[model samples]
Target chain A: MTVKQFFKSNAFKSLAVLLAIVIIAGGLLAIFNDLLFVSDEERFNRTIEKIYGGSATVEETLTITDENGTFDKGAVSAAYKMSDGNYLIHSSGKGGYGGDVYLWVVVIAENGKFGGIEKVLLDTSDGETLLGNFRDSFYENFTKHNDELVEGKYFGTSGSDVINNVVTGTTLSSNAMCNAVNTAIDFFKSAVLGEEVVSYTYLYEKYVDMTQTTIERDFAANSVTLRIVMQANGIAPSIAFDVTVKDGAITAFEATKPFVQQYDETKIDESLRNGTYFVGKTAEEIAAALPDGETLDPAKLEGLGLATGASRSSESFFRAAAFATANFEAFFAPENLTYASYVDFEQSTFTWNYTEGNEVKMHIVMQANGIAPSIAFDVTVKDGAITAFEATKPFVQQYDETKIDESLRNGTYFVGKTLEEIAAALPDGETLDPAKLGGLGLATGASRSSESFFRAAAFALSNYTFYLTGGEQA
Target chain B: MNKYVKTAVDGLITNNATFKLVLGTCATLALTTSAINGVGMGLSVTAVLLLSNVVISLLRKVIPNTVRIPAFIVIIATMVTILRMALDKFLPDLYDSMGVFLPLIVVNCIILGRAEAFASKQPVLDSAIDGVATGLGFTAALTIMGVIRELLGSGSFFGIQLWDFKIGFFTSSAGAFFVYGMCIALFTLISNRVEYAHRARKARELRVPAEGPLDAPGISAKEEA
Candidate 1:
């Protein structure tokens, strides 16, 4: 049929009717679409306030259209908010597991320090891979370091002790989040702080009741239990007190939780058998091994490990040891004259230095801040006193070059090698040794699988800290 | 009753706009996604169809044949626009759901076809009945297709769940084509059979002997005697 004849036909006439109807309907719709626009804007504002933890203003709002941007009617929009009060801000520099790096600005002000992260959202679509681990670990990191930040330190977590660092194949996402927080900090300093030369203080408060003060001295138990609560409020509310006997002789003193030095050496020695450290060694031997001179510095001892690449494994060990020592001091130290019982943090290691075989007496002290207590192990070296020696903990032994080669060439799991062991096995001309792998294990031929394992391990280690500190018993 | 009313009803049901006449296939396909949508579209078209048919019938004597097509189109457009606004304000959901199909009804072959054919020759009441009956038939056909499609494709009847169902095959665009094919095949078969039976009956009634069968027989008998 001719086109004109077809158009004039009854069937075509009906088809034309339907099309005409739809056109009219669309025109009517275009007229009322404006009414919904206002409601959508209001909903967006409320969502921003709820999600970003503050009131946000819409400086500019416009309808989304093609060729302008990628945003759609339902797509998210960007906005900014300003603080209502004074806040203390500090930066968190973290080396995420598997060589990922992150930076963040933790703000603590008004109510408390590390006032938790004001906002943490993935700004990069490419960084979506890190979402599972980074998002999971965020609140936990805040909780773990809140008090520490309040005390003026940016504590870093290592291994499973912090939140999972190697998020499900999303190292880039981790970096993006780190960058976002860093950007926020830079933005705050430049736009908010702005060359203002002023001094700020962090306030702490302690509440104490004299009527409720009780001191129990158990001579036979070689311990004392002193229960006291103190409250003080000021610009910086920390209160330091020294509890002394009536004759002015110091009995026992503690700050917040008693430090390592405040513990009675004899009582600590007696209680040594019960600590996690004495699980492998006898109490008498462990007490005897306690260095009489200054503690061995972990930073210096790291130099003794096999050198490879940049010495990441050695650095990790030193860091792990420092965190372990801090944990040891926090939980097990005595309170007042009486030695108070505390939870055993067994996931870390401790080290000290002493002279042996006439070599210059070594004094070492380790200070790792953000690893679990279980991963900690001690290594003792005496000059010419002992022949060849192995790592104090088999799990912490450094792998030799042969072991590293086997792992790299054969794709075997490098389970127990320490940084020194891995470092010694670097191939000639290779810039990075296992020590420099940054908490990642060598599975060379099986890089992908090894990377997955690293990510999983990092996640597990980070989760462990949160699980323990959540104060919930499983 | 008037012979014209009966003629229109018989024409619409037996020579239906969809089944027999096949006048408005576009509206049928475009709007038959659900029974509710099809009915709304059907009724709106029906109103415009009735009004336009009557106007065309009333003006048949006055209007010259040269401008008849243009005159019919203008009338249909005016009626469709009014209906569109009314639907938008009162039955917004249907209006939205009908979408562009609502306005497109102005060009429907069924309405304009009747205006040009029966309405232009018939009286006002007869034209109105023709419009209503034909529109009703079209509505019925579309509603049937829509109901089947919606039920099979989405497990719903008029957008309401009839039963807890999990028919995996009906959940995609493929299901829509499947339903359309089946419905077309079924409706076509039914209409063909109905039309065939109707034509066969008419043929029998109109059948005539080739050469005066009785007179030829009588002559042959006489010659044999």
Candidate 2:
């Protein structure tokens, strides 16, 4: 058709009308889009206004930096100094029941120092389905115990008044919320107020059987003094020690309370009571110096140049020193540790056997958390990814072993996942990402045992990568 | 009644978007998790429907038949975008609750259905009335379902905790389907009865026989009278 004829045709009219409508609609939308835009900062300010009951201008946006490398529980993502002198911190807490719990904590400033938390608002959550269980009063508890919170007292710990008010069904989310608030407070203390932020010594309680009562850090001396209380186990009475560690070596070890035999008053051997043998040894050296077995036999004590007469007393002292050393390493040099550190690597084994085709099957036996009768798994790998995982020996922890075994036996969670993907699926610490776990077909309730399975999978994958693929072993 | 009023009544009861015509069931089923969500979605749809219908009705003769569908869609999508932007800026809570379903209003069958079926053939005023009536019908239906589900599933009314007792099954997608199916059945039954009664009343008012034939095989009109 000629251009003039086409212009007069019905099809040409239809095209013109449609294009006109498109242009009009697009133009109208552009105008409205510009008119109704809500920027991120504006949205945050609105949220602040809603929570604080008044509009406050942003004085300045603060950059968040984890300077001390101690932000494991949670970290502040953004901070803002409001015109009203309140610091609004956007923080995320790890170890939530589902995943990370995000929160907006407003730290009220008074006299140029951290006053207390003004209010905490739940910004968002990953998979915390039971957030409804927490009421306004539960959050109000934070404000109620503000002074203690600023003084480095954490909720869910003994002697903290906030522990009593933690919501029952949503403990993980509650803990995560507390962590988020604490992270904000920690930032306020160190960055805002220029006060020394002390790390919690209670964090080291997980690495040892003994309780770390107090930890005093001498930053100038590059040393820490830990006071620990070893609980009475078997014939050993409860004993307390002042263990000082510097440069990863034990500088001082003194029994604050003398070791007394139960129902007997006998002077303990000098070598056992003095703690001089362990003064210069590091954690690895002390761990190596100890004789094998739960109880050091008389012959073994004699071999270590210890008087065998105080065998039980010597055993208690050495065990306490060993636990103190473990705690020191865990607190100071956490990078050197892994899930394998807690597991009895000597008892655990990883074997990669040849399979038909290119697939390789690995058998892993891991004994963790001092649980006897190691748990074992047979994993199949192809192209650096897990193809199948089956529990040959079920996890025999205090948890529901049957349910754990059933979930692990399903094993599709790890089937298509590579070593890095599996490791990144869950958080480093105790927090398990429920959304990721659900996507992987792992049950959140069986998280403790699931972690064991994950460790096993990691071990198998690392071995397969190292032996079969000539990759670096994790 | 005025023709405009009649058209609106018919849109609401006889040609209801949710229960009668069974259109826009996606938003109805998904967003009726709470009564507040139902109101928000219904009103948002109403605003979009009203604007799109008016625009389409005004341009009905100007647009050619071959490209009417695409033209209607572009108009409807524009209206929905404007509505979304307004809601996000002014009413963020409702916007967050509506979530992805807010944008999906662009393809909602109710707006497009009215544009094609009613607005294309009707006057601008009648088309606008039909939009409001149909949207209100949708709103009523969604609100009823939301009330039932929220009451049973969460034991709450519009986020107010009524009681702790709850049947968790009612909060699931399957529960939404069940509620939707039951509402459709009940609405059809009631509307059919009302329509039958109204027709009978109208016939009686005009002195016409309700059911019997005017002429029988053995009887003439005079004999039947």
Candidate 3:
């Protein structure tokens, strides 16, 4: 065919049209890509707000590599330095029942005790895994466990906590979650705290010694009982404290042991300063006042100096106080309460019946905030006196099992107390009013969890319907 | 229904790519692990479908019949590449979640089938609507299947837990086949019933014109009594 005939041929026409379309489409796509592209900084900035809820800047991103080849795809992939001087590490958690799951953990950079985790946001995960944890607010339970971390204590958890055990038939998924968190914590310890980034996996292993720390919930008083018995990494004594928390408030911040001091310590007590330390101060106040690093705020330490060579004992007291603050704020968060988890949070007193062995079938009641079907706590009342209290599977995961075991043994606080007495004793929002709580000489040691009975009492009084007779009651 | 609307409805229901036409079976069955995942895959397909249809319809007059298949494929592949990049930049989470499915859109028989059967002859407007309807139909099918699989298999609705109950069987690829089969059976059953009812209604109208024309077969009639 002639050149003119070829130009008019169908083959030539098809090639020309196809080539034209490809070029035009390519140009258009490139333009769209440019217009719609989100830089890593911008993408992280937007995602960070969904997590933290305020404006924050990305300071520096610590790239994640599968260095030791430990995890599947999860690692603290990026660390952004925020404009507000806070650090948030974006980590990925892999290996769910299905495959890979991802999340972002925000580290609250406090000066002392390795700036702990402030919030955990499950960004993207397998649908099954998310359903099992998300709707139930089970991630809150995971982050709550982080509060029990006393850097000075024996390393990190061995990873086989009971809470990790009962995460909806997906323990491997839970392990992935714990590994992701540990990755971020390790990054924080090395990058921020400047400590040796120890590599003790906190999941899929037996805790170094699970028995060393206790974070029991006082079922009777609706309080968090803390009994930390462990030797320190530094000069601090083998410290112990029975820190008490009720309704996100500290009622008892007393050191069950002596507020460790080596030699004659400069007293911040009477005749010296009014707003000094310990007795007059709340744990939250002390925690808030505590500095981020080894040094206490010079002003707060005005009269009392870390007596020369007595830094261990003094610093230990400060660290204990920080932990007490975190335990109250993190452990007793209203989200932990089953009653507060229902839609009718104010009036959510749903109950189920549980039959005791060779005994009357008693009704168990729980309070909640959101409409989630799972209630956090269940209380049993036999003949108007409380008997047994059970926190649901998800809620139980929020505290250390050893602590709950210890706290539950004090069932005497609930076994005999009337519903009214239990309600009255609940730490009045944050103030510990033992008088309202039946003022029984329950133990001289401040086990911090003394008020759990009140939670039992409050649930019973609101849910139990005795005056109406054999009616179905929660 | 007007011609444009009918074209759309036809694409969405009568000639749905994943069900009736059975095109793009692999991606439909694979990416539908969650409700949102199904939607994500569906929307991506729709975007590519719409763009490709418009281009192919626009170029139909210039391409020869003998070389049209390769020409159409080239054009479709270009659109697919552009779409893949746009999705990656704009919807990174969706991009990651979709994994390999976005690039696989090029092989989706639905796109080429429409180009060959309809776009080559239809007007640009009609082709675009066809693309949308067909994409929507594919999306609707996948999403419904995803909803069933996600809800029954994992006890979740759109990645959110309604309860902690799972059937286990629905989460597997075999489970995808089960759900897909049930959906096709259900769709065919309903369509057959509607077709049967429409024919019956037409017969009834012929028997008695006094009542009126039957227009409830998902069609709105402008006829007057």
Local accuracy of candidate 1 as per-residue lDDT tens digits, A1-474 = 999999787667555654554465456545644432335444444345544446434333323223221111111122233344332222222223233222323333344322434433222131122222232245344444444333433222212222333333334445444433433333333334443211111001012222232333232233323333232222222222323121112234333324112222222222221223222332122222222211223343323332333233222222222222223222222221110111112222211111122111111111121231111112222322211212122433222323223333232333433323333333232223456565655544433323322222222222222222211111
Tell me the spans in candidate 1 whose CA falls farther than 4 Å from its real position: A1-474, B166-181, B195-225
Ranking by DockQ: 2, 3, 1
Stronger candidate by TM-score (1 vs 3): 3
Off by over 4 Å in 2: A39-41, A55-61, A65-77, A81-86, A91-103, A107-474, B159-167, B202-225
Candidate 2 structure quality by residue, lDDT tens digits, A1-474: 999999999999999999999999999999999999988877786787778667687799887666732365688888889988999888888768778888888898998977888888777673665454444557778788767665555555221123344565457778788778877888888788888775443332322232234444443365667666666655656666778888778888877664333522145555445667778876655554454313444553434555435555566666666666655533333112244443443333332333244455655555653332456677788777888887665444344565564646677667887877766655664334556564555544566567767777776665564434222233
Best by TM-score: 2
Model 2 clash number: 1
- When only chain A is evaluated, what TM-score does every model earn? 0.26, 0.43, 0.33
Model 3 DockQ class: incorrect
lDDT of 3 by residue, B90-135 (tens): 6766765676577778889888888899889999999999999999
- C-alpha lDDT score of every prediction, in listed order: 0.42, 0.70, 0.59
Query: Which segments of candidate 3 are over 4 A away from where they belong?
Result: A1-14, A55-77, A81-86, A91-104, A108-111, A114-144, A147-181, A198-474, B1-5, B77-99, B150-174, B202-225
Clashing residue pairs found in predicted model 2: A95-A431
Candidate 2 lDDT (Cα, 0 to 1):
0.70
